[model samples]
Target: MSNLQAVLKQYWGYDQFRPVQEEAIRSVLEGNDTLLLLPTGGGKSICFQVPVMTMEGVCIVVTPLIALMKDQVEQLKRRDISAAAIHSGMNRHEIDITLDNCIHGQTKFLYVSPERLRTEIMIERTKQMKVCLLAVDEAHCISAWGYDFRPSYLLISEFRLLIPKVPVMALTATATEQVQIDIIDKLEMKPVRVFRQSFARANLSYSTFLEENKERKLLQILKNVPGTAIVYVRTRKRTKELADWLTKQGLRAAGYNAGLPFKERSDRQTAWLKNQVRVVVATNAFGMGIDKPDVRAVVHFDLPDNLEAYYQEAGRAGRDEKKAFAVALFNKIDLEDLAENVEKKYPAMDVLRRVYQSLANYYKIHVGGGEFSAYDFDIQNFTGTFGLIVNETHYALKLLEEEGFIQLSENFNNPARLHFEVDNRQLYDFQIRNPEFDTFVKLLLRIYGGELFTEYVRISESELAQIYFVPELEILKKLSFLKERGIADYEPRRDKPQLTFLTPRYDAALLPLNVFEIERRRERDRQKARAVIQYASNKNRCRTILLLEYFNEMDGKDCGVCDVCLKNKKNEPRPEIDEELGNQILHYLKSFGAVTPRALSQIFENVAEKPFLQTLRYLIDEEIINYDQVGKLTLNSKYHS
Candidate 1:
């Protein structure tokens, strides 16, 4: 075996590489700018990781996912490999220590978010490290045409210019031809070799069932498919409702979302991972860092907004190279809901400005103030006071964040803090005079030490409660009393999202709104929504083939086991098959998203109407074709030959 394979086997306990993994690794080791398009669970990390193990310097991995970074770093550390990550959630002291480790040759891998790349500290510290390679995960985010675009990704090209000699590899699980081309151009990659593995999932049976009774259908599917599964819902509320319903039905399930406390989220995830829970009903937040290989099913309780997200989420199953099912339950109302969601995602420019102005007023920041300041924001409180719809308000805040005016971090947790307002003598006098509070004060001093005197120190209320043999509420009450006595400045922990103003507030009317870009994004989003609608409403097309074609992989054959294929098999065979005529009909439908029978008949003008009509019926009866909601003919997507 080669040294790279040996290293992989030794560290990861793998004797072989997944398709395209070794080739991508070889390109990176040879110092080539490579673009890798592997599906989810395709082992994209090992492609750069193994090569970095072979190299002499630290590999800088740029990714936007903080949770994924922490997971990978922890995994590496467990394997005795040195790695570290820097993210926004960490304090300056922690970040400084991590960066120092990287600079002093104590770390081999440094994972950082793209937003941090622009920081002066990151740029300076990075200059001090001997960087071997640069790897950009989720590279599609760099493309404006891509589904999820982040302007901060544009900074990567600038960072690349600083380290011109370092070879860069961009990796993404889902990227279309347009997104692929845009990634290369935007990253300014020279002579980039793009390695695209087939987007087809052989082990995954993709099926979409349009049923009015979705809950019943969901229960049936869960009962039929017996293994670990994930039921994706649109909102946190839905997650809880569905998970509760599932649990009451005697299934081991739990709800997961960003709104849950950090400890609870971790516990639920651990339970699910350990098979203590069979299913996790969650929003999109629950699966990025998850690496379970035996997930037999992934059911979408609600339709995702785009095909890319659906494909990634479904791809999570069958990663162990075993047969699995990805089922999507939808109905007519879902299509309407998808349309409404699209509207909410891209609201009017004026509406966005109104929300921005309202947020500024709510924070009570004067114009030209609040720049570079972050505050705890309560979305429910803001919306209730303003009488705004929750969903629209969320979208508006997101748009503002995207436009670079401010940042909104959902489900943020600010730790409890305390700073001494008086010197040691005063604190000592108060402790002696008030003997009832002496033990708690001494415990705080012993635990946090001198940091509490200079600046705020994070303290765990639960820890304090345990030490003092008091309820958490009592601990809080005591802390409040200490603050009232001017012994210390104590701030309780806040478990809410934070919003930071990146720039000074401007007049609501003149908020520098980009009308052109907003309109462009709206049009693009409309197209995406239409694509998703087409996929869900489709009844005849092969689910796998349709998904592959959406990602620009057109040569894929049918999956042969989807709902359409099963229906075709059960129905009686057609009388006679006309190969040439069927090919023409399939070609026509493929060119247009969908077509009506009358329009299709007119296309074959020379052919007699009687024979053409008969042939169309034959294709329909044979299950090679089907009709959509409005009588538009579509190809039966389950044929696999």
Candidate 2:
């Protein structure tokens, strides 16, 4: 075996390469700036880790997902691979210890968020260290045109400059050709080896169901796939609600979203990971750091505005080289709701101005006041207090954050959790008497070896429970026992928090009313959403073909497996709509005002050919005219014309 492969097997227990993982690792080992475009669930970590093992200095991996960073760090420590994670969750002392370890000890991997690099001390730490490589996970976030872009990622070039010779590996699961270029430009990578795997998961069956009763449809999909499952929703409340409802249907289910208290969230996640919970219904926030291998299906309860977000979230279903189902549940109304969300994501200038005004008012600062003021603004409550729409207000707040008006705090309430509460001896001792809890406790001890004796370790027990099922109480009791005996200390979990932009602390007048930036951001995001909508609604080829083509690969053929192929199999003829007649019918309705589709269809009946009739039927089918609960046509979403 190669030295890196030996290290991978010795530490991670994997004997062979995972497709492109070994190649990515070799690229990093060869001191090249490698851009790895693996699909979601492809092993992106080993690309940097194996290289770090072969190199001389610490690997600085900047990842935006806090849960992801903590998860990977814990995994490394479990394998006795010296690693540590630093993020906003850490206090001064925690930061001091972690940096001290990196500086003074044999730490191989240092995981962090891009936002954390803005600090003077963090930058100084990198400058002081003998850095081997800078691996930017989710590298697409650097692009403004990319889904989930963070402006803070722009500071990475400065980080690269701090340690000039370090080769940077930019890794992401999803990126369009445009996003790929933007990522390269933003990260300032050297002309690099770009390893892009085909953006196709042959194991995953893609199906989109157009049903108004989406909730019922989701339950039906669940019934078909019986193993570990994840149901992705857009909101935290919905995550819990769906889980709770599914559980009531006798399906051992639970919801995971940002709304759960920290301890409860960890406990629920741990349960899902252990197969104690059959299904996990969660918001997009839940899966970044989770790595359970047996998930049989992933169901999307709401349509994501863009495919990048969809691919990453849906891609979570299967990682064990097994069959998995990726089902998208949608109704015509979901498209409308999705459009509204995209609209709301980009704040209007008026709303942005109101937010600045409100923050100033909240802090009792005048136009030229409140410079560097740090406040945790809750979007729902904040908007409701001022009679502004929640979506509009939140969009405005995000704009402020992007413009450097404020530093947004995402989750201060649900602090990071760790499983390591004691060292090998103590944890080994605890597991001895608790023979009943042996496997669970040992898994905890093995996986989360870092920070077992320090302050409370933040952990997601769910991933650990992936190998064994145990109650949170069972894990907590051991932690509490250790704390009581002074073997380990534990802090119970609290909440998942949402933080907002840092307002002008005292310099209110200096806050730039940048209408240009806000509008530009809105346009960029909307254009992304428009592309996904256009692609999905196209009729010329297989739905899978369109998706593969979008990723810039040319050899893709009709998969003979997607919705379009199925329609073809059933002899569902392409409904030809007469554009001229359709336009005339719509125009006539607009001229007369508030006519039903039945009336419009009748008005054009004499002129209607088979195609025209089909077009008229398609219009009614699409609700170009509004459909009542009784199926009568009326006006909604747009004018008939």
How many steric overlaps does candidate 2 have? 29
For residues 1-641, could you state the per-residue lDDT of candidate 2 as single tens digits? Answer: 77877888887788998888888787877778889999888888888887788788788999976667777887898888888887544556567667766776468899987877777778887777878989999888888777777777888988788887889999998888888898888877776889978877766767787788987888888897789888888887788788788888889988887656667777988988888988888877778878888888888888778888877877887777666887888778777777777777765565667787776676566654443344445566766777877666666776777765655555444343543444668667866876765775556556665554443456654444445566656666755675576554455553434343333343444556556755676787787677666654555567666667667767876765566665675576656667887778677656766655567667777874677667766676465865555655555547633
Regions of model 2 farther than 4 Å from truth: 356-389, 404-509, 538-540, 567-641
Q: After superposition, how far is residue 65 of candidate 2 from its true place, in Å?
A: 2.4
Highest lDDT: which candidate? 1
Candidate 1 lDDT at 169 equals 96
lDDT for model 1: 0.84
Q: Write the per-residue lDDT of candidate 1 for residues 238-288, one digit (tens) a residue.
A: 999999999999899999998888778889999999999999999998888
Instruction: Give the CA lDDT, 0 to 100, for residue 19 in model 1.
Output: 83
Q: What is the TM-score of each candidate against the true structure?
A: 0.77, 0.74
User: What RMSD, rounded to one decimal, does every model reach?
Assistant: 12.3, 15.1
